[model samples]
Target: MGLYPDDIEAQASAIITTYRDRGWLIATAESCTGGLIAGALTEIAGSSAVVDRGFVTYTNQAKMDLIGVSAATLDAFGAVSKETALQMAHGALMRSGAEVAVAVTGIAGPGGGSAEKPVGLVHLALKTRSGLVDHREMRYGEIGRDQVRLATVRTALEMLAAAAQTPA
Candidate 1:
């Protein structure tokens, strides 16, 4: 069986605790995974200190309007591309005043898949004062939409934890 949301919540709790101990704050910019990353972090009590905020920018327009993702980036790289993901992470950091930020965008669909980008394709980006980190993941193609989202959330939380460790 796949991991549950609560399990992801627990992981996020650990992440928040670690970051809080080190005096860091985090923000999230989400697309296909919605606010699952932020929701997982907030699920833990006293997450306010570590979790600055979360932005659920599910649409291209929202990404631009809410997070300052440029229209040029979106047009040049598409919403799911690493370029857009990096821009989203940078935008979240700029808007949320967090020490670190994580962004996720992808085609999590049973319907939106194409030959180049499949249904389970996910792109994650992490931004810190030092630099940006990015990852592209393709989860098991057979899993349903819910499972794909869950996988993305877990990966995002893990990335957040890793990003929190970076010196700001």
Candidate 2:
């Protein structure tokens, strides 16, 4: 009922607390979820201590320009693929002061569904400066656009927390 639901607020709070305690920062590279992941994290007070920046790269050009996702990778794997997600996370990590970064690229829609790449199919990647890169593909299957986006945000928050807890 708030800006973010209770579960999202809890997850965001946990991630922010853990990262801040570890003296770590986080950056987000977001596509279909736009900046919702970043928004959720920053919604918690004292987030400035842990959130470095967020890249809302909703377009291929924006992905390349903002986060350095390679054009070749985009051409080959499409923006929604695990490859682009990894590149986005890696690029965000390399570009920002954050020790941890998470990237999301997906087709969250009522119109962009295909047999191979349907709506609600999301690819997420998390990268740490200490050389850990994790990727996950989620198939939510025709859920509404808002639902898919929110799911991606929740998953991204989970990833960030997991990465922060992992030994660097």
Candidate 3:
């Protein structure tokens, strides 16, 4: 079993409430985590005020088309790079008119693990008008795909809360 959606919803609700109190909006660009972050946020009642939008760009092409992630960056560093994550965050902020944005890209797998970029290697990026924050985390090998994605969603919400609390 995985973390329940309601549990994720509760956390997301608290974060959104905090942001709404401060009059800030948030967007998300998700790849390996799929739309789990967005789904968690939207599961909360009255999330419309704080959640601007979510982009589920699971493929290189989708990242380019939806969030304007450059093909060159994807070619150079693959979809899981910090550069791609930053670009995804920046693009979400640029396109969604949100005050803050979080982006995630990673290789979460039982397959698709190069020795360099192993399974469970996740890169997360948070972008605001003021600056950007990025993190690379390896979640102890393959903990199953769902577990990795759930962890990613939780991490993103935590980052969102931190970002919302920051002075703009």
Candidate 4:
């Protein structure tokens, strides 16, 4: 695996400090980045107070089973889609006791490129207990698979940090 980005570490630390101080917990639902978001969070000491758990739903079945991602949504919009990302984030909130949840679905590949959903296309969604959802779509252009995944992780961390800052 490639080196995890420094900004991700900083973002994770900030998130931990913010959430730990606020007595808030977080969860993650991941696809292309696997569990890197969770990994980054856990890399920080004392993250247990902030990180509740992680769902590494690398497969469609895992996504549906672990986080309640709808099969219809996956079939209709495909896995790496805004709709799926939204579902993943919401599902994580439902499944965990976390106040904030972040989800990432993407095509980080050297091979899985299409005309529309090309490689390095990532969709991130942040869901809060206040019933607000924020979605971001990133096109990192066909950077190497590790680079794309790291970029996605960084974006997810930023979203989580922002969501933590939002007033509940």
Ranking by TM-score: 2, 4, 3, 1
Clash pairs detected, candidate 1: none
Off by over 4 Å in 2: none
**Where is model 4 more than 4 Å wrong at Cα?**
1-3
Clashes of 1: 0
Please, what is the whole-model Cα lDDT of each candidate in the order they appear? Answer: 0.83, 0.93, 0.86, 0.91
Candidate 2 per-residue lDDT over residues 117-140, each given as its tens digit: 999999999999898889999998
Clash count for each candidate, listed in order shown? 0, 0, 0, 0
Could you give candidate 1's per-residue lDDT for residues 1-168 as a string of tens digits? Answer: 123456786788799889899888898999988898887788788899898989999999999999999999988888988888889999998898787889999887878877777888888888886675656555546477888888988888888777766666
Model 2 earns a TM-score of 0.98
RMSD after CA superposition, every candidate:
2.5, 0.8, 2.1, 1.8
Candidate 3 lDDT, tens digit per residue, 1-168?
Answer: 133566677788899799889888889999998888888887777889999999999989999999999999999999988899899999999999788999999988878879889888888999997775655554547898888888888888888878877887
In the range 1-168, model 4's lDDT, one tens digit per residue, is 224567777888898999999999999999998899999999898998999999999999999999999999999999999999999999999999999999999999998879999999999999999877899999999889999998998888888878877787
* C-alpha lDDT of residue 61 in model 2: 99
On lDDT, the candidate that comes out on top is 2
Superposed by TM-score, candidate 1 places the C-alpha of residue 59 at a distance from the truth, in angstroms, of 0.8
